[model samples]
Target: MTGTGQALWRRVPLWGVDASLVALSLLDAWINLYGEASPFMWASAALGCAGLFLRRRLPLAAFLLTLPMLVFMDVAVAPMVALYTVAAHTRNRLLLAGCALLNAAASTLVWPMSDTLSGEDRTWTLIQFVYTLATAFAPVLFGQLVQARQDVARQLVEVEEAREHESALYAQTVLARERAQLAREMHDVVSHQVSLIAVQAGALQVAAKDPQTRDGARAIRTLSVNTLDELRHMVTLLRASGGRATELTPQPTLAELQQLIANSGIETTLAGELPPGISTTAQRTIYRTVQEALTNVRKHAPGARAEVRLWHDTQHFGVTITNTAPTRPSVPLPSAHHGLIGLRERAELLDGTLTAEPTRQGGFTIELRAPTHPS
Candidate 1:
């Protein structure tokens, strides 16, 4: 269809009609360049020019007027341009019907004057009369067909675009449902186990004799409890059904670092205003990291004061937990646990990094760098 439009517009025949009309108009003036009735020839030429100007706007008026104007001046010129405009722009069928009759009468009047007539001249003039009627309507017919084709093409394009948009929306809906389902399963499995670990560890801490043993158990208890709550909130969020309001649920933030440190029995200090709505994954990782660092502090350097610094820079939300080395030399550190491995895994999931090494001030520092979503 698009190819058809290009071909139709580019064809020489379609353009030739208008070009021939203009040429005939100019030829009329030249043939009567110097004549006995030069005044009437010039007047007819002026009318032809005026008809051309009004062809697109007042088409019916121009076409009707051209017939009388040409006949009165004794001119025999074709008005193919104005006739085509009349067919295309005007809606008055009677006017076109009257114009057709007047045109046939005018053509017959000039038919006797031309010397090109033979025995077939009457038949030729009749055929030409019918041809003139059809040719006058060619522009209107072609213009209508073009408009209809363009309308159909536009509709098809709109339908294709609408289908693509619907497919993309469906895919996003499927992905969101899958993510919510995974969040539910994670909550169900981890929450119960963490809660039990925290309760039992807290109970064990009460009966421990030495301060180091007590502090280690207490650290485990706090981490377990926080992990449990976080998991529970995640499950609640997934279990919700219908409407946007159901999506809300409890979660943790960096502000809870103090309570996390207290339960670890580490002398912790915090500085800077904490950001809000710290993601669940980020908070969970930070809590576990702090728990591990403080437990290591208590087990290896029992009397060493622990410092927990949590602050948000322009780019990263950081957690730096450092503790003094054991006053007595050669104290053995606690055995490595799954907590550090899990913390590393969690950080990697969020495209963050975690490092545990000795700080410049002679203490072990657990540094966590998290890419936070800005509030």
Candidate 2:
């Protein structure tokens, strides 16, 4: 059948199908036993038709219920359906073969006993028995074929899903390789040139006689150093793409927090200290949060004074960075605006939270809170 037709057939209620099969079996019984006034024959036919309803739930018992009708009256519908149901639901080959033999015997031998048994009659009876046995196996084979078809379809679906998953992983692997290549170029070429520029500017600042030239050279050296710091962080992030947080290496810890604040170019004060024995991941998270916050203060709030406060309670440890409003006019700087987002992502990996908002005093505050022993 076509896919659409098969889907519609599956949507039909199961009870409705069972009821229809029962009605068909009853009709077959009536046609075979018409005009028979025997109450015993009618009862047997009624019982056989009723047994069809239980074929799916109780296949063996339902087939046994229809045996009497096969022996007394020639009825094939109910017995064949029950045998098919048994074959479809079970994988016991010996049981199915025994059922087929019983079905053939019950149908071939009628109820009435013949007093005179001739050799020709015996030969004819044997032929009929063989033919009946072959007929009984027809539904059994068909039911098994249907069961096998359903199994193959289910296996095909699983294979397709696995193929799609493999394809997705392959794509991610290719993208990560590209990002690694880009990071290598940035570190090898761009970082090397920037380091040389910083060195040249420092030498010029020392050798120059004019005050203005010395000041310009000093500014260039500081900017170059800041750019190199940002570049190193970017390279680390690119190298660790498509992996877990623990894969990130060469990460800064709380020990570097003092150096980070001093190099940030903003007037920043470190207020408190965290207890020792913290995990590397938590320390990195705290360090990144403070780094990003200080960077933001220097960029967007010029000449701002910032304070870094580190505190811990019994359960949690965190850092808060608050900066005063800009004292000088701020120059607009081009920004990708991903620093806060990266900090938040790192905090989440350590089961932490980060919040950045404007304070009522016309300044900005960035805070990070995390569990001391994160899993």
Ten consecutive residues with minimal summed lDDT in candidate 1?
239-248
Off by over 4 Å in 1: 1-135, 195-210, 224-375
Clashes of each: 0, 0
Local distance difference test scores for all models: 0.62, 0.82
lDDT of 2 by residue, 1-375 (tens): 999999999999989988898899889888988997378988988898898888888999999999988877888889999999988877788999999999998888855747114555788778889999999999899888887776567545545544554454455456656777989999999999999999999999999999999999999999999999999988867754543243455777888999998888788889987778987667877886887687677657866899999999888889999999886555455444456656676677668898999999889999999887777
Q: Best-fitting candidate, measured by lDDT?
A: 2
Residue pairs with clashing backbones, model 1: none
Residue 86 of model 2, lDDT score:
88
Model 2 RMSD to the real structure? 20.7
lDDT of 1 by residue, 113-231 (tens): 56325665768767866765565456555544554565457545545544554454355345446656777667656665676788889988998999999999999998887787777
What value does the lDDT take at residue 206 in candidate 1?
A: 96
**Root-mean-square deviation of every model:** 26.6, 20.7
